[model samples]
Target: MMWLAVGAGAALGAWLRWGLSVWLNPVSSWLPLGTWLANLGGGYLMGLAMGAVLAHPHWSAETRLFIMTGFLGGLTTFSTFSSEVLTHLLKGNWVAATGMILLHVCGSVMLTLLGFWQAQQWWGRA
Candidate 1:
């Protein structure tokens, strides 16, 4: 049952990720905007989901797994990010590679915190 839930979530997440790439990747050639947005958004969504799960402990583990491990695992394209970084390095564009790394890492951390805090505020009052 857990596996099924995760698989279903992953399928949907993967499709969504692909759509983001198709739609937004063309906007920039130097950096994959779609993948970047995916990571940032995934981080925020992850934090929100975790916050909700923590606030409502009665929820099943499957629900958490489906959202975080399954959906997020597929939505955030770390592999694609790595490849893009490698591509930059191979082309001797160290600045671009490092910039991308910093942006994704910092942005992810910040957005995750923001999302978690926002979710907490939404549920903490109760």
Candidate 2:
């Protein structure tokens, strides 16, 4: 059942990631905006799920696996992000490549923190 949970969550996450990429990627020429966005969003969601788990320790392990390992595993696009950076570097777009690496890393971290904080607040935790 754990495998099923992960597979189902992954399928949904992958579809969502694909939809986001198709919808937003073409609007930018600097880098893969969709990939970056997915990473950041997935980070936030992972944080939120983690915070929820922390607040409610009684929750089942499978729920955590589904949201954290399964959903986030599929949603985050580290490979795509890396590939986009490499493409930029190959094309001599150093600034864009650097900017993307910095932005995605920093942005995902910030959003994760924000999501955790928000979840904590929602759960009435100090």
Candidate 3:
């Protein structure tokens, strides 16, 4: 049952990730804007989920696994992000590579915190 839940969540996540990429990634752009956005958004969502789960301890571990491990695991593409950074390095675009690395790391964490804090506020009142 757990496996089925995870698999289903992963399938949905992958489709959503693909759709966002197709919708946002422009052919002419050098940077992968779609992937960046996906990761950042995923971070925020994961943080929100974390906050919610913490507030509502009644949520099962399987439920958390389905959303975080299964869904977010598929939604956020760190492997692709690494490959893009590697490609940039190989092409001698050190500045771009560095910037992307910093932005993805820092921006994602900040957004995640923002989402967590916002959700925490709602949970606090509840």
TM-score of each: 0.95, 0.95, 0.92
What are the runs in model 2 whose C-alpha is more than 4 Å off?
A: none
Model 3 lDDT, residue 53, Cα: 88
Put down candidate 3 lDDT per residue, 17-99, tens digits, no spaces.
88888888785256688888889999999889889888898988789889988898788888888998999999999998998
Candidate with the larger lDDT of 1 and 3: 1
52-82, model 1: which lDDT tens digit per residue? 8878988887888888888998898888989
Give the lowest summed-lDDT range of ten residues in model 2. 117-126
Query: TM-score for model 1?
Result: 0.95
State each model's CA lDDT, in order. Answer: 0.88, 0.88, 0.85
Candidate achieving higher TM-score, 1 or 3: 1
**Stretches of model 1 off by over 4 angstroms after superposition:** none
TM-score, prediction 3: 0.92
lDDT of 2 by residue, 32-113 (tens): 7778889999989877887898899888878888888888999998888999999999999999999999999999999999
Kindly report which residue pairs in candidate 3 clash with one another: none
Candidate 3, number of clashes: 0
